[model samples]
Target: MFRLAAVVAAVTVMATAVVAQTDVVAERKSVMRESGKYFYGALPRMLRGEAPYDQATVDAAFTAFADSAKKIPGLYPESSKNAPRTSDYSASPKIWENKADFEAKVAAYGKSIEAARPKATSLDGLKEAHALVRAGCDSCHDSYRVRH
Candidate 1:
């Protein structure tokens, strides 16, 4: 009975560690999806003139984007940089290998969001803001993400 209890405890501890590791991925994925909602969804619609430039959606999307940017540095811990991704895309090991560069990129993302938020007031402004925001995302992905 003691042996069995020890085995169960061991399994529980292992499972808990696994869950904690994946939790970071899950949290980042949630934030990414929220950011994508505008980049892939609402913004595209507006760009194509399928929908009007809805300031409300723009506000919500970029706000979420900025908020998520703030969370990026925390999300990409050393352990998480190369953990088996919950999805097809995973963060590259470069993040850990070049920690300073990765962190600088994350800071740039936050700055991009900050520079873009006020531009949400007008369509042309939003278009520019969207471009800047996407540039930051793309730049980071090129350097530190494996999207396959």
Candidate 2:
């Protein structure tokens, strides 16, 4: 009876860990998608003059990027590295192997957002800042993302 109880408890713990890890992966993907909406959608149109520059929209995008920078490192706990469920992109195991470098890139991204937010008030200013911000993203992705 004791052995059976121990087995049941172990299974329950494993199941819970799996569920938690999956949730982390989903949350990480959702955060990235939020930033993608701005990057792949309205922001570029505004930059190219295809859409009118809207301060509120720009502000919202910066806010989303800032929030993502803060949350991303935490979402990548070791357990979530091998979560059974993932999106088209998975975090490279390099993130765990070189955690410091991965986190430094995220920190740089946050700094870029902070420096860029004020400049975003004008079209040209936003364009210049956008390059800096995009560089931060590319730096991290180049090292840390696996394209599925």
Candidate 3:
């Protein structure tokens, strides 16, 4: 029957959308986690001298962080504001309510990344850049995301 076919098609479409949305959440988390591995993991180890201070690694990490920054705004589509399957930060409703402000925060985050990457060529440089990156993340988290 046409009605049965229509129902099946509708269900398939909705299921596809849900899968896509879940993938978006996974991707967004992956991007952030990639940066975190650099920021919180590698950078600290280098700072403490627990790991060798490799300028190349520092530069690469910051560059990667900046690359992830470019992908930030795109990752946060309206549909991504809710993903029941993901343990990602429950992004605040403020992102949807005042999208302009949300976008402005993202711009600021990018600016910080730009400032941080170049400064990451040496240990002192990397430390300074790390501070800026931390400040930038704190600012955005304070406004746009809910901590759990």
Candidate 4:
């Protein structure tokens, strides 16, 4: 009976660990999705050419873009071995398949946004910056993300 109880306890502990790991993965995926939304959703608004493309808007959008980029490397799973079989994930295994290429694009994106930082002092300046930043988004999404 004692042996049986020990076996059951071990099984329970193993099950709990698996559940905890899955929860962590799910949480990470959720955060990655949110970051993608902020990065992509802001682009259309910036492109509208109607919003006050002032310093504040530029600062906010650029800050958000930078934050989102920082999260990208973390969000990408180390391998496709554990990737979800089916879900709303816009990211593709191609990202991991060509990890170096994907990472390079992400780095270029950060550089483009950083370059726009000093030019965002006024509406016209912000508009120009918006264009540059939008281009970066287009570049990455074109290569890495799938529309759903």
TM-score of model 1 vs. true structure: 0.90
For model 1, what is the error of residue 145's alpha carbon versus the real structure, in angstroms, after optimal superposition?
A: 1.1
Q: What is the TM-score of each candidate against the true structure?
A: 0.90, 0.95, 0.92, 0.67
Which prediction has more favorable lDDT, 2 or 3? 2
> Could you give candidate 3's per-residue lDDT for residues 10-60 as a string of tens digits?
999999989888887788789888888988899999888799889877877
**Best candidate, TM-score-wise?**
2
Query: Which of 1 and 3 is ahead in lDDT?
Result: 1
> Would you give me the overall lDDT of model 1?
0.86
lDDT of each: 0.86, 0.89, 0.83, 0.68
Q: What TM-score does structure 2 among the candidates reach?
A: 0.95
Q: What is candidate 4's lDDT per residue for 1-148, written digit by digit as tens?
A: 9999999999999788666656555755665555456445554455566444445545666677787678767656554335443455456657777889988988988898898878878666666776777788788778876665
Off-target runs (Cα >4 Å) in candidate 1 are 1-9
Per-candidate alpha-carbon RMSD to the true structure: 1.8, 1.1, 1.4, 3.9
Q: Give the runs in model 2 whose Cα sits over 4 Å from its true position.
A: none
Q: Which candidate is the best by lDDT?
A: 2
Under the 3 Å rule for N, CA and C atoms, how many clashes does model 3 have?
0
Q: Candidate 3 vs. truth: CA RMSD?
A: 1.4
lDDT of 1 by residue, 1-148 (tens): 9999999999999888777779998998888888888888999899889998888888899888988888888887776655675787888888888999988888898899999889878889988898989988998989977877
Ranking by TM-score: 2, 3, 1, 4
